[model samples]
Target: MPLSTRQSVIIALIVASAYFMENLDATVIATALPHMAATFGVTPVGLSIGMTAYLLAIAVFIPISGWVADRFGQRSVFGGAIVVFTGASVLCGLSNGLVEFTVARILQGVGGAMMVPVGRLAVLRSTEKHHLMRSIAYITWPGLAAPVVGPALGGFISTYFSWRWIFLLNVPIGLLGLALTATFIPNYRASTHRPFDVSGFVLSGVALICLMYGMELVGQLHSDWRITVAALTCGAGAAALAIRHLGRAAHPLIDLSPWRIPTFRVTLDGGSLYVVSVSVSPFLLPLLFQLGFGLNSFAAGLLVLAYAAGNLGMKSVTTPILKRFGYRNVMIVNGLLTAATIAMCSLISPSTPRVLITLVLLIGGLCRSMQFTGINTLAFADVPPARMSSASTFFSMVQQMTIGLGIAFGAIALHAAVLVHGNHAQLSLADFRVAFLLVAVLVLISVLYFIGIEPDAGREVSGHTRTASR
Candidate 1:
């Protein structure tokens, strides 16, 4: 039976609500970090544990979401995730100590890990191919709004109300999401059953955890040789184990064979690096404004609002650019633009006009939006529907892991510069300028990955006709 328009809208709203909560939870903590640190009697580095715990939990559980959805049913899984996430938010708000907060965040991450991809999958399963783009556009709107609103909302609540309010706000939103999901989302189960790959799952989880932890540790240790060596060793060993396990397994949790496809491989590599570049800015920008520029929490939050505004404004232009230039051209050019904007951020100084800084952030946000849309769309453009599940899981995992690593890297860089300058107590504005420049250079290196893309790789995405003779 054909569904009514209202039913479709309701389903989309349910999914978007879940996505908004997930994205908001990811960034809302940024503005609250200092307050969280003071309350827990920890340093900036210590507060990172909160972010790390959530990220690590998401990384570990992402692969299992698909399996669970297939086993139980999408509607059940989706509804249950909302419950877990909302309950965890309550726990997070109620926690007093760092350990308790971290634990609650882990639970939140588990729920979050399930929420997004599963919700998206639900939308896709319900919508026809012709309407897929519109459905995706609708789902993406909340995600765009989350980052824009997260900083200001977090700052306002943490400053006047308390950091706990940030988490508490999710209660009402989650409840609404739950009700919608139960009412609108259809139950879905896989027809062809594949045995659960227990061994593969364990190895992949171990590998991801080790890699993320190592990258995070590298950021924390900076120039500390011993710590860097230890982290690298563990990370390398875990990666090797995962590779070997996947090669032999009948049904690996994550099939690395996708990497053999040149297009998929190039896209994933570039996407991972692109994510790393974009992810670091949000984490570092708040600290730069509040600590270095001497802005109050609310003012710093407002600056972040500029970045989000740019992101929102750029979305309308993204598809047209991709259509005109094609994916390879779009990615290559936008990647360079993103790198240039990031480099421009390094030029910020205490005496720099607020208008100039805002412009830089705005341009950076626009370029980043283009970069993200291009990368995400191109990553799956060539993927056949049968492999969509694995591809989705792989893409989601890389994106989340890179985001965590990027933030960790930014923090480490800032801390190292401060330590080297022998000014830990007073991190000067100049120090932050140097850190932004360093990250910009790192972002520049990511452009090379986009350069390797095949010119013809994304033709279908741009609506160009393929010549049968070719």
Candidate 2:
């Protein structure tokens, strides 16, 4: 039976709730690391191992999520993942030592890896083609808001309350999600069963593990040069092998058929780059306000709220705008406008008016939210029903990888700028200028990919038609 519009929107919101919990958990921990380290009797840097354990678990497990969901059924797998994640949160809050905390985090990562992709798969399965724009918009907001909101929320919680509350808070949310999942989500499974591809899983796992770890290393200022190079080199080599094996395998772990569609290909190629570029702003903006403008952390955080507001502000109009402009036009025009705003950040200084800075960030945030919705929605617009699982899985993998790399890219750009200016002692406004410019150029480069798309691409989902050029 086809789902009603109301039913599809409800399911999308349910998945969005899950996505919010996952994204918030990933970032909220960052601010509480010092407090967590104090409880564990270790330095802040030492406690980073707990995060590493979590990320590695995610890297190793995500490639196989589709297969697991197919074998066990989406509801069973997704609901079980929530149970595991919620249970792990409780264990994390009660941990007495670093080892126990690390173990709990790994469990959380496993649950997160399965929860995200499978939950999204469930949404895709339930939603009709024409309603995809609204469905994707519902799910995209959490990702835009979480990065801006997490640190401030974590700091507030840690200041007045216990750092443990961060994890414990998820208990109520997870339970709610579980109940909703059980009630609304269907037990969807593939019609035909395919054997698990163990070899493909191992190869892809190694590739993602190395790739993610390498990006992590590069983001750290004091990481060893040789290890970073080796990790990246090994990741590239493993990725090549994994691609080769997946191409020839009888039942590949992740189906690569979606890449054949132009709309899907644009998301994987251009959309990934766009994500990487936009992600740099959040990483760089706080530094720019604090380091360049001499503002306190709280003040800088307040400024970022404007950006978040812009993100949320766009949600109401995203569907109508896409319906009005279509994907290709929206991406090309909005993408350039977004890049221009990013570059405009480079021009900001102490003398720049506060209102002006906020306005720029607000505009940038609005453009970013629109671009993300368009790219993500267009990805599956042309994907067939049979290939939906593979397409969603593949999209999730690329999204994770690009988000991780975005932070690393920002760090590298800032470091390079510092070196050029010969300011090893302290960073200056000049450094941020160069970094913002580089990131803007990256966003602009992604525009070319959008240009390759047909003007009427994704018209079915957007409900927009291009008139003949008379």
Best by TM-score: 2
lDDT of 1: 0.76
Q: What TM-score would you give candidate 1 relative to the actual structure? A: 0.87
Candidate 2 global lDDT: 0.89
lDDT of 2 at 230: 93
Candidate 1 displacement at residue 205 in angstroms: 2.1
Itemize residue pairs with steric clashes in candidate 1: none
Q: Return the TM-score for each candidate structure.
A: 0.87, 0.98
Q: What is the lDDT of every predicted structure here? A: 0.76, 0.89
Each prediction's number of clashing residue pairs:
0, 0
Error of 2 at 122 (Å): 0.9
Worst 10 residues of 2 by lDDT: 461-470
- Tell me the deviation in Å of residue 261 in model 1: 3.6
Model 2 residue 185 CA deviation (Å) reads 0.5
Q: What range of 10 consecutive residues in model 1 has the weakest lDDT sum? A: 461-470
lDDT of 2 by residue, 304-404 (tens): 88888888899989888878877888899999999999999999999999999999999998999999999989999999988888888888988989998
